[model samples]
Target: MRIAELSRTTGVSAATIKYYVRAGLLPPGERTHANQVDYGPAHARRLRLVRALIEIGGMSITDAARVLEVLDGGDLSTWQAVGKAQYALDLRRTAGPGGDPVARAAVDELLARRGWQVFEENPARATLVEVCATLRQLGHDDFVGALDEYAEAVERVAAVDVAVVARQPSVEQTVEYVIVGTVLGDTVLAALRRLAQEHLSRNAFG
Candidate 1:
């Protein structure tokens, strides 16, 4: 297929596809002639993934490029690539680890109690501390009290996520599934949560 066909198939513009190639987000196609390049299904898949990372995942082009680089280069295993990609997309890493000490202790306690073998430097630990601290500041003790429930719910969700990703047959497909599933899955989960809240609210308050 040509660039136009690739673009049409992926719903990305030809200009944007060219830009992605130039930006190193997508690889250059095979040169067929002096002015003709032939793109394959791999190119189409990559273009769609690029668009998903940027447009759906809310990742900047630079971040998306970094993730693609991690996936494309090195001999990392599929899970390792997925872990690195998740780290690359973790915006919380850019936030300094200066959250409340009390909240941090609580989060640490929660992790230890659950026996989760998360890395100490995981940015999400700090994010959890920050959220707990903010909730405390706002006097939302009742909401904060549900931390265990929230953790349990998310654990189940994570299980489902991994189960779905495990069905992919190839390493490339598995990594891509992780990237796309996790990024867009957050959005899907949030939307479903909102709908559930609304339904429950209506039932309870009516």
Candidate 2:
């Protein structure tokens, strides 16, 4: 297909598609003639993936490009590639090492209690610590009492995610599943949570 057709199919502007090609987020199409470039289904898929990363995932073009590179490259193991992409997708501003010690201690205890072998430098560690501290500051420290429940639910969700990704036949497909599942899945999960909360609240209050 031509660029216009690709644009129509993707709901992305032709100018933005050109920009993505130039930015290395989407690969250039085949030059069919002097002024004609032809895109295939692969191009269409990639364009959608790029838009999902940038628009839905709220990633900058640079980060999206980096993730594409990681996915396309054979240098990294599947675990490493997916981890890099997941790390890049984390948009939260981590409260660095100097965050509240009480919160850090709580996080440490949670990790220990859960037997999670996460690296100390994982950005989520700091994010969790920051959240705990903020809750405490707001006199909602009891929120952490439900951390185990949240963790258990998350573990089940993670299991489902892993099972789906594991079914992919290739490393590239696996990485794509991970990226899409993490970025878009987050929105899906949040929306479901909101609906569930409303339903439960109505049941309890009615």
Candidate 3:
């Protein structure tokens, strides 16, 4: 297929496709002549993957490029990429640097006390640590006090998630659910939180 046909089929602009080709995210098409080129199914699949990473996965171009590099290099597993992408999206959405050392240390100690094994490679763990650090720097000592309750809530949520996964009949479906949940679950929780807030505000004040 020509660039125009590829663009038409993929709903991506010709110029953008060219840019992707130049960036090596999409392999360059075969040169038919000095100014003409022809693409194939590989190009189409690459384009789709790129679109998913950028649109559904909410990755910036640079991050998408990095992910493409990993996919192309064949060194990292797809599950690892999925985890990395989820972490990147969460970090982007939750804006704020790590809090002071005092707060971070407090959170770390709390986690240690709870016997929660902190995985250095897990982005979610890093995010929790950062949030705790920020809360501590803000002089919110109550945040430290809330660790027990929060841990309980986390456990409850994890159990519920596990139950949901157990209902799936196959390992593939279970893994798929986990990957999709990592991204979509945050939205579900946010919506639920808003509803809870509305209910509290309406009844508690009255």
Candidate 4:
């Protein structure tokens, strides 16, 4: 198909498509003539993936480009693909609590107490510690106390997510499923939680 057809099929603007190609997020289409290009179904699929990373996942172009490099390389297992996506999305923020000994010990204790095996250099550890510090700063220690309970629930959800991705037939399919599930599922879960909270609030207060 031509660029106009590709644009129509994808609901993406021609200029935006060209920009993505130039940014190296998407590969250039075939050069059919001096002023014409042709795209294929693969291009269409790639465009959708690009859009999902940028629109749903909220990844910057640079991060998205890194992800595209991984996706383009292929041959990754489901675990590798999802892990690479997570790595790309990680902003590697400064350690929270600024290396407070108490916060650091608390984070270590929480992991040990939960029997969770997390890597020392994992970004999630720092993020969780930062959140704990913020909770203490805000006098919301009860929430921190309930962190274990939250982890228990999340572990169950994570197991289910793993099973869902495992059922996919191919790496590409699994990557797509994980990307959609992780990104859109967050919004869906949050919306559901708010709805449930509203219902309980009405029942308790009305």
Q: What C-alpha lDDT values do all the predictions have?
A: 0.83, 0.84, 0.69, 0.80
lDDT of 3 at 94: 59
Error of 4 at 190 (Å): 2.0
Which residue runs does candidate 2 get wrong by more than 4 Å?
93-98
lDDT top scorer: 2
TM-score of 4: 0.84
Candidate 3, residues 80-176, lDDT tens digits: the string is 5445544544444454565466656766787787788755565665666677776666888697779878787777777787688668665444444
In candidate 3, stretches whose alpha carbon ends up further than 4 angstroms from where it belongs are: 32-35, 75-99, 121-126, 137-206
Model 4 C-alpha lDDT per residue in residues 50-166, reported as the tens digit of each score: 898788767788877876676666888777787875555554445445565666788898789878887786666777777777788899989988878888888887889889988
TM-score of the candidate numbered 1? 0.88
lDDT of 1: 0.83
What clash pairs does model 4 have? none
Question: Better model by lDDT, 1 or 3?
Answer: 1
Q: Give residue 89's error in model 3 in angstroms.
A: 7.1
Off by over 4 Å in 4: 91-98
TM-score of 3: 0.59
Q: Relative to the unseen true structure, what is the C-alpha lDDT of residue 167 in candidate 2, on a scale of 0 to 100?
A: 94
Best by TM-score: 2
Scored by lDDT, model 2 comes in at 0.84
TM-score of each: 0.88, 0.89, 0.59, 0.84
Q: For residues 79-176, what per-residue lDDT tens digits would candidate 1 score against the true structure?
A: 78767766765655355555688888888888887788898766667778887888888999788788888988999999998898889887777777
lDDT of 2 by residue, 1-206 (tens): 99999999999899998999999888899999999999999989998899887788778888788778877775667788778766656556443554799888989998899898898767778788888888888999678878988998999999999899889887788788888998889889999999999999998997
Using TM-score, rank the candidates from best to worst.
2, 1, 4, 3
